[model samples]
Target: MMRTRPLKVALLGCGVVGSEVARIMTTHADDLAARIGAPVELAGVAVRRPDKVREGIDPSLVTTDATALVKRGDLDIVVEVIGGIEPARTLITTAFEHGASVVSANKALLAQDGAALHAAAEEHGKDLYYEAAVAGAIPLIRPLRESLAGDKVNRVLGIVNGTTNFILDKMDSTGAGYQEALDEATALGYAEADPTADVEGFDAAAKAAILAGIAFHTRVRLDDVHREGMTEVTAADFASAKEMGCTIKLLAICERAGDGASVTARVYPAMIPLSHPLASVRGAYNAVFVESDASGQLMFYGPGAGGAPTASAVLGDLVAVARNRINGTTGPGESAYAALPVSPMGEVVTRYHISLDVADKPGVLAQVATVFAEHGVSIDTVRQQGKDGEASLVVVTHRASDAALGGTVEALRKLDTVRGVASIMRVEGE
Candidate 1:
């Protein structure tokens, strides 16, 4: 009979998610051990400041040395929750070298250097599962990699960052500007003080890369994701969306393009129809809508991030990796089989809502119409306002390349009749 000993695990960070991982390890020890078919022990915990007070974990398990913990050679698995690009990446690689599997929630590291990490795991024949890295606690990664393994997903649109979603939700419901909604989110602990990652679309872009990689079986890096944040969106955009039966949500969209020969990923504030399921997703919650050729439409919705919620995802990966280890078999490795080129944003085809300020005159509409026509973009609908010198001309365009629309805007800006381009919003969920 094979000797069954406890699976010794080490945590590389003792922050919010790490703390919950430790807590759950102790609270649900028996159940986890039974499911894992062996003992699951918190062999060690690494922290930057070991003196920080942590509840539920015995002081003996804590250590200030993170590198030493991964070097413990005896460790069966290493769980890393530290979010960064440098030390976390190095440490995870070290763990794989030391013959231990790794589970991480570092989206930045994953999005930037995922191919390297996956190659490392394949070389060592060890499991590397990161379910919590994207759409925290939503069980998306494993399902995309394993359960939906056979399905050919065509599109994945997600509200993956909770802080931005909360702020945007407030803006959508109350017509609040970016700062006002951000202040409210910060007061409620939904946003941090600096808020660069969430408000600037950095966080969503990172998540988009990861989701795109798995959903489309392509290698998508952070640089390939086109990103536009919600800071520039105003009440006028929201009002216009409401008038058009739409709601604005920051979305990370991944689609196969080039006649289904390539993949593209982008993060931007978009107008989703009020009747769509993603439009109903409010507050700080997250949701991902996936469309496949045979699977049809599927939606995954849950808490995007929190200590306990993220911990749930971490534990799920731990169980899977541990099981694969015991079975002497590895999990699904990186699947970039399609190896499709990540297309740039300008090449993507989508509908647009362009609002422009023009002179309230008869020939103004005709001039604007000519500019769009010159760029090969057809207008779906046109709305004009104002009785005197000031007028607003809103043009909703049919599906066209972003490059074509951009050229039309540049031409209109230099025109003698058009005053300014008020705003341009992408329309989706139609």
Candidate 2:
């Protein structure tokens, strides 16, 4: 007879991800038991409203008082899907203090206060696993935290937000403007009513913070990430992308500085060459590309977010934490050992594509090229076309610091020959 520990789990929130947690718990019971060498059971469910009907769940398991549920006796694990910084953080801390391991899908809470939560878990010697907090259902946090435990990771570049990727992919394939693609995504339920977090790059920035901290074993907080949303990305940007043999994607990029003394993490819309693997990751899917000393380039791709997919990731973490419990061992904790400083955006090195609307004069092109030269940013290519009293100058520059590029743009904007600086975009995945 196999020795069974009879794990009791309390799940909070029955939203998209929580319902899937219940469904999988019911169907995978025997398999879960076999894998854990024990019977895992749902002890309780914490929800805001108790009157709402929920299926595949024992009515006795549901409760309106979430705080009271965590305080109840004998909970082996608490899975939090409520998602916020306040009660969720307080509830998770309480659960850990009460001798329960925690599995969470709360990215904001984790990104904002992961350090505090991890400290609480450490003080109580409990597990705090949040595999679903990043890319939904993609095996990223685990692989970065564990599988690459020995490898030296230099970079983690990803399309970590699904809604933005879906919108961008739609725009890429259909040549639709930002609003047009956003409308289609909204109609399809891929985007929320507000869509601020997804489109504005806030969501991806949080994920980047979490990923940078883990990959570099440093405390890279959410505020440390430089965020520039994709709302400003126009249809013309996509058209220019096509002209340059590229696609525009909202990328969450984190990389170790060349000196290896610091790291840089940012979320912004970027133009990437079509040959890159990440360019092929279309629709609402997510992909993460990692560069390491030992592992040169590695990519993990799958459905980024959905209730069921994210729940699947939580369950996978459940199995790992459960087995670790049976063995009386704790997994890795926050490893900011690299303790690298988070660098500013001005220090980042990348290529740029600058579109200039200038007065149609004989020397306008040379004046624009002169501005770039003064800043030490060499131009790779320049294409100019004259229109009615105005000319459009498209200049692609070789790699240079963001500071240098910004200086060049500032000087160009001041030029008498330049009517206006239309746009400046970063070129990535080259």
Candidate 3:
């Protein structure tokens, strides 16, 4: 039996994603209602600019006051497309307090204050679903949170940010410098004007924090993630990557460390082998490689951003939350029961590809080797090329703690024979 009473949904924000959500809800209203076992209605839409005309939304639904809209006691679901902390957080909590479930695409807010938000939802006995937060429409959070609930996920490594991936992929394919690739991405509208959040790894770091928390069932905050921007990635880095039969990508990596006692999450530009699934992920696309004991290795790939793609994910969560509401229940809340401690970056063990500018002399290599040996970072390979009394010495190291690699670089910088540390990139997927 289907419910005759319509489920009232309030949309906060009428921007790109919000508009698409409304469009879909209107066009696919019958289908959504049939699937959800209840008629879904767009009861209200709140935006900052009420004067701006939205295609399908009613003028009566548009309002400047977001708080007032969410506070409306009749709303059954509040969908937040507003991507920020202040108003979004407060609005979500208010929605729960007033008896409404929430579906959000705010990664930054969730990554920072997910625990509090989850608590608020639990207190109000409402569902808080954010499937679109991490990788646009890639369907990641649900799998890690629900699908893989029975399995133990050991590792999650992938290119999660499409902007950074576009820049890095451009650099690899065209041998363009970072500026050139970033400029192209901007012109193509794949990058924002500021682009700091995406290029600087802040965006990916937030996603990493979310993934690490859910995958490991721990409370991983945004501050817990180790972030390194890809702005410094040069054509020379791509050249070195090609020489090693690899390609460069800005990766978000999360892992369980040392018998699952701790977990780690980081975002950085790293060299993944050419054959790896992530290296082949070209242009503004996303792919994640998940490793587990029973599942072995699984890859989730898709267009990570854009209004329609992101809206698809938001609608998926909408149907889910709607169905749960019809059933008089809630979905999975925060699974931080594991409470695994997030280890510092220094404790992360990984291989590294380090390029150094040094004097073209015999003992320079020996001095560098001594530093690595002293720091307990074993070198896997060393390649030296000389030109005009200057040499570019590239050293690939075996799996070693980040602490040892940092000490090695610090000591190498102090050496007179070493001109400078040109670049240091982590080697992954091998």
Model 3 Cα lDDT, one tens digit per residue, 342-392: 999999999999999999988999999999999999999999999999999
Estimate every model's Cα lDDT from 0 to 1. Answer: 0.91, 0.92, 0.94
User: In candidate 1, which residue ranges exceed 4 Å CA deviation?
Assistant: 1-4
- Candidate 3 has which clashing residue pairs, if any? none
lDDT of 2 by residue, 284-317 (tens): 9999999999989999999999999999999999
Candidate 1's residue-wise lDDT over 230-349, tens digit each?
A: 889888999999989999999999999959988999999999999999999999999999998888999999999999999999999999889888889888989998899998889999
Better of 1 and 2 by lDDT: 2
* Backbone clash count for every predicted candidate, in the order shown: 0, 3, 0
The estimated TM-scores of all candidates read: 0.98, 0.98, 0.99
**What TM-score should be assigned to candidate 2?**
0.98
lDDT of 1: 0.91
Model 1 clash pairs?
none
